[model samples]
Target: MSEQDLFADIRPYNDNEVAPAIQRLIADEEFIQAILHYRFPHMPGVIGSVAAPLLRFILKRKLAKLKSVQDVQRQVATFMNKMIETTSKEITFSGLELLDPKKSYLFLSNHRDIAMDPALVNWCLHQKGFATVRIAIGDNLLRKPCATELMKLNKSFIVKRGAKGPREMLKNFSQLSAYIKHSLDENHSVWIAQKEGRAKDGNDVTDPAILKMFYMQGKKQGTDFATYMAELNIVPVCLSYEYDPCDTDKIKELWQKKTVGHYQKSEFEDIDTIIKGIVGFKGRIHVAFSAPVTSIPAEPDDLAKLIDQQIWQNYRLFPINYLAAGIQDSSIDEVAVEQWQNRLMAVPDGAHDLLTQLYAAPVAKKQ
Candidate 1:
């Protein structure tokens, strides 16, 4: 098999196939049951029981027009814009003027809130007449009933993890590569994280292997893996949160990682975090769209390093990262990252929590 085939085997979003995909998600009883339990616990069971299927029946046929990916983009864009207009909530974005809807882009952003990282960016892109990018959802996330349905609706395809068979791994990666290429070739932008997983420490670092696999996927088709790399039009996106709504969850998870050497990964808990994060109050959010990186050379090592540096610039930081760093290291300047927090009328009470959670090394040294 050609290396290009490995990278380019991704199943493109087909209009004809969307209904079946939607049907599969809508009919998954576990999905319906979970959403009801989590989101509508107060409503009688009969409500979702009748509501889900009825809702499916009403919209299933309409998905035909959604066959054109552009149509889907417009619908999602319109829906997002309308939601924002009607809500009291607001998100101030900078650097979006840098984007070009006429060209396809590979948008790489930091992962903060489980759901909104991509949603917010897509919403902004939609406003600019750009198509919504296909998102990458971890295969582990499908284990949760509610998240599975939600992610698919938002143009996310799964990335399988821990496959035992060599064939399975190759097949999965090939398909992913193809999907990304097709998205760009079609003028639909792609959105992905820099690393295979979220940076729990909030220190944004890209894994070389992740970008390596990206180009390798299309090698099977005789596509100049180098050419594919060059065509990616990589864009750095930063999602800044004034305070992580789930800082407590992050701290608890880190505590587990340090003690157990590995934290359990599951989709249900992630779904819970996403739900709570969106509806929960966020003091401020900034989604910055940096210029695209169009210069990718063929050398694997060189290409990966180049991509890594670009993404690092966009890694969003919490105000507390500065505070934590300062309290831990008396030598460093505290006034740097904490400027935003200090300017506020009343900073979050959890600034102390952040210091304690993040500065374990210093605490141990003093002890």
Candidate 2:
């Protein structure tokens, strides 16, 4: 098969595919209902049922103008600007001066929030006149057809996570690795989380498996691991949120995992989490970009440690972190302590220690 045909199942939608995708999104009853529920969270069930068709009409009219991927991104950027202005107190970024605008990079970033981590990274790059990236989103999150449509429209490619057999798993990973290499070859940047999922417990460790997957295509080509990795121009990115919007939910989930040994999610839990992440309040935020890795390591484990060091060192620790770590000093005042205590009041007493450990992990890692 041709390269285009090989990657057709995993790649983002092209310009010619945008119109049909938008039309499908508009016609999808699930998508329309999701929008209605998100926009009018407190509306009665009867009212929501009545409003679905009207919501579809409004979406059709609004989305009619988005003729291409660039147009869709422009529309998203407008909403993103508004979201940042309203939900965040401040957003600071650094290390953009170290990057060349003409070069393509693989941005391997610490994952914290489901939607906001990449969205914020893309926003920072866009503001600095850099081309936006093709984000790697896992298939586990795309349980709905509408979800897949929305993600593809936003330039996200799927990472197949549901392979049922060892051969299928290898095939999926090989295709993903090839796609990443192909994107870089085409002078397009890409963003992928350091691991498969968000660091829900606030521990941002790079999984070596992720690095191995990244090298799959190169290994098949008989290239040295270090040489292939250096060719990708991998950049380690650090994203720090002073207050995670989904902290409480994350704390609960972690608590369950610790106490019950497993935590189960509802049918629409991921969707709900995505909505909460977007509309929820986040305090001061920081996105730190490190210079691309030059001293490439031969082993995935060593490379993971290197990436972890950069993320841990560059991570911005807030006053809340210190308080959660039980470090009382000049940096953390009585008011901060009181506020943190009040926040803890809403959490279950049994899970209080887990919450503390969540925020304290980064502080400990940095130290």
lDDT of 1 by residue, 184-204 (tens): 887777788877765555655
| Cα lDDT computed for each candidate against the true fold | 0.63, 0.91
Clash counts for the predictions, in order: 18, 0
User: Where does model 1 exceed 4 Å of error?
Assistant: 1-13, 19-28, 42-90, 144-150, 217-227, 265-267, 297-302, 314-322, 327-367
TM-score of each: 0.72, 0.97
Superposed model 2: Cα runs more than 4 Å off: 329-335
lDDT of 1: 0.63
Candidate number with greatest lDDT: 2
Best by TM-score: 2
What lDDT tens digits, residue by residue, belong to model 2 across residues 47-75? 98789888888888898999999999899
